[model samples]
Target: MNILITGGSGFLGARLARTLLAQGSLALAGAPAQPIQRVVLVDRVAPPADLAADARVQPLLGDLGEQLAAGALPLADVQAVFHLAAAVSGECEADFDLGMRSNLDATRQLLEGCRRAGHAPVFVFSSSVAVFGDSPEQRLPEVIEDTTLPTPQNSYGIQKFIGEQLVADYTRKGFVQGRNVRLMTVSVRPGRPNGAASSFLSGMLREPLAGERARCPVAPETAVALSSPGNTVRGIIRASTASSTEWGARTAVNLPALTTTVGEMAQALERVAGKEATALIDWEPDAQIAKIITSWPSRFQPKRAQALGLAADESFEAILRDYVRENPQAVKLAVKG
Candidate 1:
């Protein structure tokens, strides 16, 4: 079987690809576990060094929109598709056109191509917690439930919500075997900050630990739901490999997440790398970023995801320790105050 992974070069995408390759096989929606003959990484640029060199990986460069319009995206014989490509929240808010084109239009084009392919491929849409919007006056559930209707407050969130609906409808029509998972904010991201309003969530920990200064965009007390890259990739793989009958409903569910405050994260850093690493984080609050981030429900009653066997991390402290242990050369040794 062949798999197509949009945004396959990204942190989670790349990780998922490697995980799939390591496993050697994937379970197609209606089929038993089969060998993965190829993994087409559909992205705008070349895949990272490690992923590109693999014999099974095919790096197809350029945006999916242009690629599809030009009749370039390989849709036929693609047994599965993991839609992880998207314009991040900060970028979407900055450029509405880019967001609409990347987050909404690109997804539609992909689904349309899948419909045209004639094969009912397993489609996994990577949605976000941003789908749930909360505000000062209009408060959300303390722990967002699976039944809560999406109330997106920003362009990125709205786009993802629309994508979820698109995947569900497409699956309902039997055009594709679709499933969606509302991923939490992924933290301790490997690369530099991108345009996500929540980018600072990882930056505050990633940069400081790397001996570089980072700013905390939100207040110390403001909490955010997050998941580790390992856990996040596991969720994606599980969603992709699940049998159609096993999934039952096509709606997106919130993946389990660890909720922690900025202060707690910084404290975890201090515990791991010392007080000096804590000082590396500048306490500068950005209201615009905070508004968008805070609008996302931080606590989630992700019973559905847990029941599906998706796991959440224990705490922010554990996440930091894992990052440090995994990237020993990139991280600095703990310093005494």
Candidate 2:
């Protein structure tokens, strides 16, 4: 089986590639496991040296939008596709054209490519929790369910929701076997911050562990939904492999989330790495970022995802410890034993 992963150079994208490589095969729920022949990674930048060095990896570097419109992706032979690339929330808000081009236009072109391929490849679109927001028509419920209608309040969310609908329609037409998985904010990401409003969620924890100062754009008490990198990757894979009957409807599946406040995340950091690490996080609020981050619904039932055997992290502390363990070189502060 040949697979394709967009955003292949990113943290989660790279991690997912490593996971698939380690497993050595793609196993659909009802179908026999197929040994991975090659994994074509599509991204603007090349993937990590370790991932790129793998014999099975084929890195296709360039803008996804341009690549797709030119029919550049090796789609004809691809058996599975994980589309994870997008302009994040802050970037989308800052530049509407960037979001539309990268998120909406690129998605449409990719789907069109799949239709032309005529193979009906399993296409997994990575949606976002930002898709759920309060609108004048209806205030958000205390807990968002699988059946809740998405009322996107931001351009990023709007783009993701649109992508989800497109995937649904494409599947309905038998052009592709589409699966839409809505991911929560993945916390404790190892790397410098990106344009995502939720980047601070990972930054605060990551920078502090590195013995560097970090800014908290939202209030410590601000509630947010989070998932570990491991859990998020697993949920994405589950979405692609589940049988049609097991998957139920073609609607977007909300990946499980661990709901917690920024205050609690700080507490968890202290528990894992001691007060010195937590002290590095400065309470510097950016109102625009806070507004966007808070607009997303933090609580979720995710009945559909749970039924698919996906799960959230046990706790934020465990997530912190996992990050430190996985990226030892990134951690300079003394982690509690």
TM-score of each: 0.97, 0.98
In candidate 2, what residue range of length 10 has the lowest lDDT sum? Answer: 25-34
Please report, as a residue range, the 10-residue window in candidate 1 with the lowest summed lDDT: 328-337
Candidate 1 deviant stretches above 4 angstroms: 335-337
Clashing pairs in 2: none
State the lDDT of candidate 1 residue by residue for 200-295, as single tens digits.
988988888889999988889998899998999888888876776667678897899898888898888898888888889999989999899878
TM-score of candidate 1 relative to the true fold: 0.97
Candidate 2: global Cα-lDDT? 0.92
RMSD to truth, every model: 1.6, 1.0
